[model samples]
Target: MRSSEGMPFSVVTGALWLDLVYTGGEGDRSCWEALHTPTDVAAWAHSSGVVSDPSAVRIDEADLRAAHRLRETLWDMANRLADGKLPTSDAVAHLNAVAQRADPVPQLVLRSGVLELDRGRNADGAQVLSAIARDAIALLSGPHADRVKRCAATDCALLFVDTSRPGARRWCAMSRCGNRDKARTRRRFEKG
Candidate 1:
């Protein structure tokens, strides 16, 4: 598995719903640059754990486009939630269309003395997109709907679920936005 660092997707959000929104950053810091080609899509799917076997999955330009479109819709929906407003009707419809596509059905199997659940061996790009759409829907309608938030960093547009006990998480990641904000605060104090 590839680390979140250097990958086109940010896995630091701790939830697939937020991670999908983080795919395209705010302003000019977008991370979907690597998703322009089929090969890049395959790499991102593998790194993001969207597909268990990247070697067997096939992707094309259409699939890449659909994935990007879904990413954008998800971003819009998440942003609306962060603003304490409902997701746009178009965004909901788009998510529903993707969610109704080829979704992976998990099956339980007994291997030796252990029982394991699997989404089958032939997971494809559509299935991955469907899974992400379902996750977004769940987050939008679930109990934690009010907990979804955008990062506090002035220039960062990443979204995250505030999973802390007190629900006071600010930055997307402590090592990234938190550290940067702290440094800026220290500089301001020194100047004062």
Candidate 2:
């Protein structure tokens, strides 16, 4: 599905990480946009694994609003962490409020001879949002917080955690920002 910015929706960086990157930038030129409708939010929720099934849950405008708020908060928090500063109080408070709305409980179940962990039934929209908020909080406070980085593509504003062994990752996704940057560099050299 397309993002509100008309860009194709991206999930390469991880659901709670940069799924909402499509919603930021300067005004007018900014891609900052909405999910369009509640069904779009529901589809995102399901595709991102925020909910088990899009068909099983009903998302409303309120739910989409909440998700937007949480997504913005997460983006702010991540940028703060990347800049070596604590997130603003408003960001922390928003995350806390959303995180309290749902708690994921893991259950261990035996399947044949192996025991596996399952998160149980699908979460509602609020719970799905909570899960994402909690994940952002964890990333902000966790050891990998230092690894968060914005894309190196001059035109891309997406952020992602550098999980590479050397921590030298530079793009949100190789096929997207990485390839674009490479092509631009190649054109510049060819002109020179």
Candidate 3:
């Protein structure tokens, strides 16, 4: 049980992947805007008071684009469910082509001279997208794995790692998004 648990954590190396897929960062620009109302990712600010920590955030615009690209890539890889068909060699070949065209990940370890697509920061402070095949494989099979989900809050599209106490968290922000949602209804009834 312990060893199996470690594998899921390994799949969560960076916050980038989760931020990209589960949030409105998944190329749903209109949804992103509606959720923010007058503010968008460009103008919005990270709430330092709420977060109180720096290491946990990965939702800036560049990370946003990277996450969307990865989401599409992953979607193309294996089918959406465990019972679904395994990824064909042809599918991998296609993804590799797409990864190469997008950008080369650092790719520190290549077994057979094939480009292993890792993504995110490299030691030199440059972005490299290599050597991620193993981690990606772990992500699909690990316990932390899921089909990914968007926030259910109608006006809040922020995403999260559902490492919830019961694996059921519904909002990106309870005080902000969730509270605002409740307040809007309260005002409506009072006005009527």
Candidate 4:
């Protein structure tokens, strides 16, 4: 799913369209994608409360191409959002523009909030992501909602809420990024 250095950065980059930057104050991320294998899809579905993991699933080259296309959609949106907060002046407009310019799958599903789609190797994977989108809207859209977020760790592109005690979490894991930062701080202190 990921290398030692980090995972792919732009997996759910479109979430930036929802103001979910991968880097910010809280240690949240904008997407929750696992590596796309048939087995991985089943595990994800089972974990996410899907009726069952689709063990009967299979993905082909066409599916891989569609996935790559989905990746591109997220990447384009993220790159645009790299400029600032959600494009308030043209949030939907920007999305629309991207939709028009980008490939077909995102264009069809994004508008209707029907993101849980099935086109590639596993129908379960698409369904899983779609479910995630719905859950995200429910969790993040209202006043009592937890703000959606992307991890600032650079390696993790996954989305989550900063549910820490103080809600000041700044990495997906303190033991991971937090420890790294602490070590760097200690190094700096020793140098001084």
lDDT of 1 by residue, 1-192 (tens): 122465332336756756655455445536445566767766666666666556656677888888888877877777787888888999999999888867655567788989875552466777878878888778678778788788899887667888788889999777777887999999999999
Stronger candidate by lDDT (1 vs 2): 1
Best by TM-score: 1
Q: Residue 178 error for model 1, in Å? A: 1.1
TM-scores for all candidates? 0.78, 0.74, 0.39, 0.45
**Taking the tens digit of each residue's C-alpha lDDT, what string does model 4 give over 39-141?**
5434544543442325534434454333334434444433343333442434334333433321212112343665544322234344434443343344335
Writing each residue's lDDT as its tens digit, candidate 3 over 105-145 gives 23344658775533322211011222233335456567646
Score candidate 3 by lDDT.
Answer: 0.39
Between candidates 2 and 3, the one scoring higher on lDDT is 2
Best-first order by TM-score: 1, 2, 4, 3
User: Which stretches in model 3 have alpha-carbon errors above 4 Å?
Assistant: 1-14, 20-71, 74-127, 131-136, 157-159, 185-192
Best by lDDT: 1
Q: Which stretches of candidate 4 lie over 4 Å from their true place?
A: 1-40, 47-51, 56-84, 87-126, 143-160
Model 4: ten consecutive residues of lowest lDDT: 20-29
Query: What stretches of model 2 exceed 4 Å from their correct place?
Result: 1-11, 21-34, 104-122, 183-192
The weakest ten consecutive residues by lDDT in model 1 span 1-10
- On a 0 to 1 TM-score scale, where does candidate 2 land against the true structure? 0.74
